[model samples]
Target: MNVFDIFWLFFMITALQPILRQRFLEAARQRMIAKIEKSRGSRVILLVHRQETMSLLGFPIVRYIDVNDSEQVIRAIHLTDKDVPIDLILHTPGGLVLAALQIARAVKRHPAKVTAFIPHYAMSGGTLIALAADEIVMDEHAVLGPVDPQLGQFPAASLVRVVREKPLDKVDDQTLIMADMAEKALRQMKANLSELLAGKYEPQRVEELAETLSQGRWTHDYPITFDEAQRLGLPVSKDMPTEIYQLMSLFPQPVRQQPSVEFLPTPRKGHEGGQGTGLFF
Candidate 1:
């Protein structure tokens, strides 16, 4: 082919790539929705967000980062009538704390029982959100990480470097300066974590966990298996089969209306009853 023809061909491929990918994604999403709809027993609303790493049948897989937008979750929750229950299939590395909290709160507030299904991993803020659900279901290989706050690269790494270089006996001006900045970063991160862990853990324990996480010493901290989560005061169960992972990856769509338990509405006009039926779920 001529040089100009080759250039044109490259341009065409680059231009069409995104469009073609988008079309394929949409088709896959439709298939998943169809599958879920065809399943027997119980009504379920599948909530997927765009922050997920993978897109099955055009629908974004569930991710912690995706839940940061409370409005999106609120919209989705509003779409559900008081009649149906929900099964939240989660696979995320975690994201913003406030967003996760908001999602968890919404799930708790809903009338339907929210069951968080972890087919892969739920780390950091993802763990926080999982706590809000009535029950958490995991496959054999699924895991949950600690709810430790991170200070990011520039802050945490720089501080550690300064601390290492400066000895107690002798310290240069630059080293002292970096050390101070690092200390401040660490303090701020700790405080943020403490706030997030309010009512969940004591301040001192939260600090300890935050430090370990911020330091990034281990590849992963508090890597709890499905059984461990149950032992740790979490309502956890093993339901999804391992083969489902392969099926999910290939089909990219979830079967709809699978059997799931619905959350009962809070009663009105009693000791814990100041709200109306409209406020339930």
Candidate 2:
């Protein structure tokens, strides 16, 4: 009831409010993860690809799942008990081909059901992994993209098309070499697709789906909406579980990157202070 006591109470509330809120949010996130795990009778695993978002003026962005992500994924999978199903929350722009296939097979062969939840989009390699899931859940607005593989930074289909459109003899030596590489990429992708679709689809549909997805019919980034996926006979549903949304809420928004920084310039041996540029996120 004294003026000084009231003022002290106000200062503490102002200082502690943010901390309290953050703690509450953290607890909620864990609860959501746990609830989803309990409901599915599976351990939850999140695989999010790096977003090409801007970073802080001089900071590094957190890396997302790419082809190199297989090592970590396999480790994570092994950490879980064998009896638990895998509730995979997949969000990626796609990465390495071999890496994707490794993950897809792991999920497909797992004894328990693997349910893939797509809150927004999963493209290329991400699509391959989703196909491995027993069930894929998405919202009406969510999308799964085409599975056309990328060879390095180049699109496999484009590379193959160039060779198809131009006669091999007409092209230069370098072009011929690239065309050969492209041909190999196409063949490898076909083989991978066929294997991936093996147990998931009927013997007939498997071939058809593989051709449609990997034959460059659609662009690599083309968004296949929930309705389109269902039409294609994928095991997909538009109704996403509430727990999934709650779990997604814990992550930085799609456009936002966690604050991080990486310094460039390899510090030489015996070098004390090497100048470096900073990438901010």
Candidate 3:
């Protein structure tokens, strides 16, 4: 080939490499999902969020649980037969409350069992969705966070409490209006969450659990580990499927100029007391 032709061919290959790599990864994810569904006899859906780079610009964009995600999940549930169970793999930091509620309600309404799998964490609105599942499977270290409603950057419960503690004349009109909205939002969240837990727990326990979750008792980012979740009466287990972890590895974080963390990808075995414990690190 001529020198110019060879140079152009190399440029084209370099340009298409990223696109081809992304396409291959997507195909691999689909195949893995199909394998899981076939082995478990359930419809599999994944709501995974990650900070990924744009194909050309390389600018990072963080994903969340949004309306589009809810729409797609609801549609998947609708397509499944009533008798078919669902396996929802969630790995997110949460998002819009309205979108989360839509997905949660849809999951609650499904005839067959709905299981939520968390290999890392599902916080805030993600936790709201997990509440609707018949069972929650998490890795031993994975966590779920609180679902207390936030008004702008502040928690709704805090806003209401602040207004109540302040003198009536000292509070501004705008603050009063915010407090009113906050109270309503808190009430609505409790009611909605209570409805989700209704059939699963006792009447009084339902209200108590709902209030605890919606009352801003803890910071929004506070992690509720498997042990704590169990103590709180949630239907949680540490029996995470290996395929779920494999699926998460496919959704890599955005590439950076310099990686923040690095480790050997393979497991290592350790011997203790002259016995091979098969310890991995």
Candidate 4:
């Protein structure tokens, strides 16, 4: 081959290398996920949320894209038999509101009773997903954070920006506009939290708790421990031992079987909280 043609061929190979590697890795991961789902005998699904990695890096990240893909997994499980019960294992730091809601809905819709096992942490959206389960099992150290929704940044920070930029005391038309926007943002966040909590708690109690927990920035909000989660009426149990991690390690990582696109959801616009905006599966 000519020198230029050889160089072009080399460039093409280099460009495709990462794509090929990613495809292979994804296929293997999906096969593992599917096998784990199937082997539980109870039509169980395993979802891990690693979004805290992005939170630490000061970037938004979608953590539960795989879990949201539960639609197809759920369908596949149902195809095997409609009567199989579902056991969902979750370990997440949480992600987008809508995405969590989607997974929660799928768990709720399954004909089997949904049981959630939390080995470590289920924060934010993760906690939301756990709420959908009939029973939530956690170890002594496991945690579930409050469902207080913040609009990307913390609500207090948004309020501070408005007040500092345009003193609320001597508000101009622009200041008034900024103040109104901030107020609306905070109000909407409060309302969303209230609504989400209402689904899990009595309306009066949820309203009371929402007022107390929705005050901080996203970074500063504290995570509730298993004890606190139980106090919040989350149907949490602490004595159960979790063997999922050990069991996962024993399973042979499955061979690459299909293209990832066949399994993953289509990518869409990014949301404020690093959550993927589109529904998957």
Candidate 5:
């Protein structure tokens, strides 16, 4: 080929490399999903969001659970046979409350068992969705967060508390209005959470759990570990499937020119060559 023709061919391959790589990764994920489904005899649905970078521009974009996500998940559930169980793999930092509620209600209504697997963290609305599952399987160090509602940038519970504690004259009119809305949001969240927890826990326990989760007892980003979750009477277990981890690896963060973290892909033991080695820092 002439020099110009060779250059054109090279440019085309370079431009298509990212697209081809993404397609290959998606196909790999599908194969892994099929393998997991076949082994467990259950429907697998993933609600994962990563801070992805825009192609070419390299601008970071954060994804959250939204109406679109809820629609897709509910549709997936509808397609599933009522007799088949479902395994939802969640890895998110939470999102819209309405969207989360929609997904949670769908999970609660399914006739067969539903299991939520958290390989990392699922906060806020993500935690709300987890509450609807019959069982929660978490990695040993995985965490969940409070399901408290938020009003704009502030927590709904906080807004209500400020209104209650502060003098009426001291609070601004806008603040007063937000506080009123906050109270309603809190009540709605508590009721919905209780509904999801109903039948799974005792009547009294359900009320207590709902209050604790929706009353803003913890910060929005507070992490609830497996032990803490169990102490709170959540149905959580540490039995993460290996394939789940494999599947997560396929959904990588957007690549940067230089990686921030790097490590050798080899397992290390305390002893090297069958002999204890001197400690090094």
Candidate 6:
């Protein structure tokens, strides 16, 4: 070939290298997706919430399970018959008390079985939702935390304790009002926890477990291991399916300082044609 023609050929090959690499990456990702899908049984839906990741830009900001999510999942369940099972893949640092309560209630009351799978961490309100599950599967390193409800930025138990321990004259009127609200939140939380444990334990024991969990016996984010959870009256198993790690690999911690996209799909080889053979990232 002529020198100019050879140079042109080399340039074309170099230019297409990135396209080839992207195609390879896309293919690998598709295989992983297929594997995860295959592991799930027929008529099962996986709901995942990874708190360490940022969900939407210019939105409510922090990524945590919320009321809006309850609406979506509940509606999705409504569309299907009661026979389908719901698998919750929970890994969260917890969020609003009421929001978590809404989701826990929906899951608890679902006609079909609801299972919670925790590979790493599910704390505070996350624990509340996990409590509602028919069965909970956890890894040896996995943790389900205290269900102590939070009011505003403070734990309800802490607020209530301060009011009870401190002199009435020393506390401000405004603080007293806040403490009153916190007490109410505590009651609500205890009642909810008791209800969630209804079928799992006796009525008196249900209230006791609820009190222990909601009374700030442990820190809100304290990691209750698999054994600890079982001891505390939660229906938890140490055995977790192998495919969960593959799913968790899909979500990495958020880098708040930088703007980024998790995946970006672009045109590769056959994409240039109307009938595309594959997509690349």
Q: What's the CA error at residue 103 for candidate 3, in Å?
A: 0.5
lDDT of 1 by residue, 9-42 (tens): 9989987775677688667756654455356222
- Model 5 lDDT, full chain set: 0.94
Candidate 1's C-alpha runs over 4 A off are 1-10, 37-68, 151-220, 241-281
lDDT tens digits by residue: candidate 5, 107-138: 99999999999999999999999999999999
In model 2, how large is the Cα lDDT of residue 95?
71
Best by lDDT: 5
Candidate 4 displacement at residue 250 in angstroms: 7.3
Score each candidate by Cα lDDT. 0.60, 0.78, 0.91, 0.62, 0.94, 0.75
Task: lDDT for model 2, please.
Answer: 0.78
Better of 2 and 3 by lDDT: 3
User: Clash number for every model?
Assistant: 13, 11, 0, 0, 0, 0
In model 5, the runs with Cα more than 4 Å from the true position are 270-281
lDDT per residue as tens, model 3, 1-281:
99999999999998898899899889989988998999999999999999888887788888998999999999999999999999999999999999999999999999999999989999999999999999999888999999999999989988999899989899999989999999999999999899888898999999989988888899888999999999999999888878888877887787677989986676555564454434231
Better of 1 and 4 by lDDT: 4
Q: Please state the error at residue 218 of candidate 4 in Å.
A: 8.7
Evaluation by TM-score, superior candidate among 2 and 6:
2
Model 5 clashing residue pairs (backbone): none
TM-score of 6: 0.74
What's the best-to-worst order under lDDT?
5, 3, 2, 6, 4, 1
List ranges where model 6 is wrong by over 4 Å: 1-61, 254-281
Q: Where does candidate 4 have its weakest 10-residue lDDT segment?
A: 247-256
Q: Please, what are the lDDT tens digits per residue for candidate 6 over residues 1-281?
A: 99999999998988776567557755664566566546664233344564342223323345777777677766765765677677777787777687788888888888878888888888887888889989999998888888887777787788888999999999999889989988888788888898888987888889889888888888787889998887877788876766666656655444457656644444444654655345432
lDDT of candidate 2 over 1-281, digit per residue (tens): 99999999998998776567667867877788888777868888888754332422323355545556888787778887777889888888777777888899888878878889999888888888999888999888989888776666777778778877988778788766776787777777877888877987689998898888887888777899998998999999866886786576565433335535534434334445655444221
Whose lDDT is higher: candidate 3's or candidate 4's? 3
RMSD of each: 14.4, 15.0, 2.7, 13.0, 3.7, 10.9
Residue-level lDDT for 78 in candidate 1: 78
| Model 3 accuracy (lDDT, Cα) | 0.91
